[model samples]
Target: MFALVDCNNFYASCERLFRPDLQGRPIVVLSNNDGCVVARSAEAKRLGIKMAVPLFQVQEQIDRENVAVFSSNYALYGDISARVMTILEQEAPAVEVYSIDEAFLDLSGLAPHFSLVEYGLQIKRRVYQYTGIHVSVGIAPTKTLAKLANHAAKQYPATQGVVDLSDPQRQRRLLGLMPLREVWGVGRRLSRRLEQQGVTTALALADCSPAWIRSHYSVTLERTVRELNGQPCMELEACPPPRQQILCSRSFSHRITEYNDMRSAIAQYSARAAEKLREQNHLARVVTVFIRTNPHSQHERFYSNSASRILGVPSADSRRLTATALRLLKSIWQPGHRYMKAGLMLSDLYLPGHFQPSLFEAPESPAAMRLMQTVDNINHSGLGQVRFAGELLSSGWQMQRNHLSPAYTTRWDQLPVVRA
Candidate 1:
């Protein structure tokens, strides 16, 4: 058996964690640069605020409804997510961190030892008690069904945030009732294709032959079908596969036409991407920098260009990445355009020992690597207090985060305060 636990309205919940007064209020978390609605609380959903709706488009409705608006507070959310995952790690034998707000647990022999429903409820209670975050738990014979059960747990209030579909009959009933789109791995396009073929429900897709599904759709879809039918095609991944590329980029709060501002933005992005590479223990051989004018602007002539640099040797050192990114920025930058966005991408990633350098070139020295590690440690511990000189964000070059919440869990100065 497998169980999936998912945080409910994660970003909104994180915002409400420190501001208890905001509980039960409509909340909307905007995307980078306050571009659009990325997350909405249940109350916001009830107000018909659709996901990805531009902030300007819903300003009137949000103001009239008195919605608690927030920019994406990722530092707070990431810290909260880590705390929740830590609590979960203690409860489950093995856990797969599915995403920032979801995890799957392996319940192999435990199912026969105890009631899965009770176990799910226990996890929910413990997590909430420890982190003040409500989570929905779903248990089933397979991961895919476990995800469906989780969906039901969150969709229906009567479940009390815990649902068990371990029974075959219960699985079939839920599958029948669930639309194909709700099934894991099935998106709107695939759901419509399946519905047109008369496989309109989760059970209908499950009933289709695995080979037939594979031939008609793809192998991944076939695995989903099998998993839906109580067969576990996927196992708990303790360590997720490494990414081939790391990108750090964001649209500026406002456009800039200066060279120094664009260079500053690219340098910051490069440092961020390199930091991610080090976090994953990978070294990148190729660095690509890109700059672009606002595509949506009618007054400005849209210009976009990108340049790539091959490192002398693969390295995860931040200084090297930032320097390369700045040089690349210089090549593609045109002075006249109002640059709206700039970014860095580090590709050709490989594990530290896996890359064999040429005779003339060598990887980063052990001492240099240690120095980088020390710097990373300091920056991580201090929420980016230590950094390269080029990393400073030029005035007005940063993303628009007008409604950002304090980094309550990660930053000491931003810790929550209480009064009696």
Candidate 2:
């Protein structure tokens, strides 16, 4: 069996973890530059505030409704996600982190040992105790059904945060009641197609002819069908390797009018991307930098730009990657344009140890390796960011606006208080 564990209203819950006063209030987290609503609490949802609703479009409604608004506080959310995952790691035998707010646990061998529903309740209680966040667990024979069961658990109150679909009759009934669009792989296009074919529910799709699905869609769709029928098409992956692409980006609080300011933002984003590349022991042959003006601001001019540079050799070295990134920024940068956001993307990635050496380029000496290690260590320890000989710091950079939250879990100074 596989169990899918998902956090409820992750971003909003993160906010409540710190400010307990907002527990029952309508809360919403805005997107970069506070442009739109990216996340909404249950109360906010009840007010009919949609996700990605532009701030200007809903400002009147939000004000009239007295909704509690917050800028995207990623630091707090990331820390909370880590804590939640740590709790799951201790309770489950093995866990695959599916996303920031979701994970899949292997429960194949443990099903006979204990009741799955009881075990899931224990997990929910422990996670809440440690992180002050609520989670919903779904158990099924396959990942797809587990995901469906998880959604059901979250939708209905009687489940009380746990749902098991191991029984065939219960699985069929739930699938029959669930909308086709609610299934994992069925999106708007596919859902419409399925509806046109008289398949409006998940059970209907599961009962479709396999030959027709194979002929119309790819083998991937066929596998989804099998997984929905309790045949596991996907195996549990342990220690999946690092990502092949890394991106670091954010929108500025206000439109930037100067070219130097744009360069500064790109440089900072590139430095962050480079640090991640080194941390994961990955090398990139291509560096991409992009800049854009706000699309929603009627008063400002709109401009979008992107530039890419290919390196002679793939490298995880910060100096080489940052140099390429800056060059890419130079190519993409425009004069006299107001930019709202800029980002750095590293692609054509490969593991550093697996990289093929160039015959012409000289290898780094032991001293050079030690120096790179020192820089990485210092940055990791939070002393300072990356520093290189050729790189010059730019003064005009956008500041992170939502960094005011207390680091209650990660830092000693910000730890929560308790009365003796």
Candidate 3:
């Protein structure tokens, strides 16, 4: 058996976690740089705040509705997510973190007499009890069905946020009423194609022959169909695959037209990308940088350009990455174009000690690795931050966020204060 636990309105919930007065309020969380609406609370949805809509497009509506808006507070969200996952790891037999807002559990090892529905309810209760974040629990025979059950848990309150589809009969009943697009892996385009082919419901797609599905669509879709039919085609991944590439980019809060500003932004982004590369214990051989004008600006012409350079040696050193990125930025720098975004991508990554160095190229020394490790430890400990000389102190090129919330849980200085 499989169980999926998903946080309810994750970002918006995080914002309201410490603010009980916000209960039933219309709240929306904006994406990084305050560019768009990424998460909306139940009240916000009722107010017609669409997901991914640009903040500018809905600014008037938000004000008129007196909607509460918050910029993405990643530090707070990550901390809360960790707390929720930690609770799950202790509550379940085996666990797989499917996303920041979702996790799956293995319940096959439980005693046959144990009640799946009751256990799912317990998970839902404990997560809320400990973290003040509500979650929906779905239990099914297969992971795909578990995902569907989770959707049902969220859609209908009658379930009380717990749904179990272990019985084949119950699975059929739910799938018969579910649209093709609601199936775990079926996307919009795929759902449209399946609808045209007369597979309008999840049950219809599930009834198709696996062989025929494989020949018509991809092996992935075939697996989805098999899983929908109560066959476990996908197993829990205890350890997720390592990322092949790391890219860090952000839309600037304001337009920039100067060369120095672009250099500053790329320098900081490179340092960030290198930090991630080292976090994964990998080194990158290729460095790419890009800058662009705002695509949504009506009066300005859209412009974007990118440049990449291969490193002489794979290295995760921030100094080296920053230098390479600055050089790339110099090559692509355009004068008076009003660049609104800049970023860096590190690719062709290799785990440390996994590959041989070229005859003329020298690998990063052991001391260098230890240095980066120490820097990371210091930064993570919240004691202080380490930076390269090339990175500018004043982040003028950085994306400005006007409505950012305090990092209540992560930053010592930002903690909320209560007084009599």
TM-score for all predictions? 0.97, 0.91, 0.96
Decreasing TM-score order of the candidates: 1, 3, 2
lDDT value for candidate 2? Answer: 0.82
How accurate locally, in lDDT, is each candidate?
Answer: 0.90, 0.82, 0.89
Candidate 3 lDDT for residue 64: 93
Per-residue lDDT tens digits of candidate 3, residues 60-108? 9999988999988888999999999999999877889999999999888
Better of 2 and 3 by TM-score: 3
| All candidates in order of lDDT, best leading | 1, 3, 2
Clashing pairs in 1: none
Residue 374 lDDT, candidate 3, scale 0-100: 89
Model 1 worst lDDT run, 10 consecutive residues: 387-396
lDDT of 2 by residue, 1-420 (tens): 999999999998888887877878999888876778899999999999999999889989888988888887776788889889888888878899988999999998888889999999999999998888999999999999999999999999999989999998999999999999989988899889878889899999888777789998768778878888999998777576788899988777766777667666766677678778877777788888888888887886788988898777776666677777778878877787777778889999876556666898654334644666788898767546666533344545565445245666666667778769
Give per-residue CA lDDT, model 1, range 1-420, as digits (tens). Answer: 899999999999999988979978999999999999999999999999999999999999998999999999998899899999999999988999999999999888987788888999999999999999999999998999999999999988999999999899999999999998899889999888988899999999989999999998999999999999898999999899999899888888888888878877887787788888988999999999888998998988999999998887899988888888888888888888988888889999888888888899977888878988898898877756676777675655878899999988777888888989
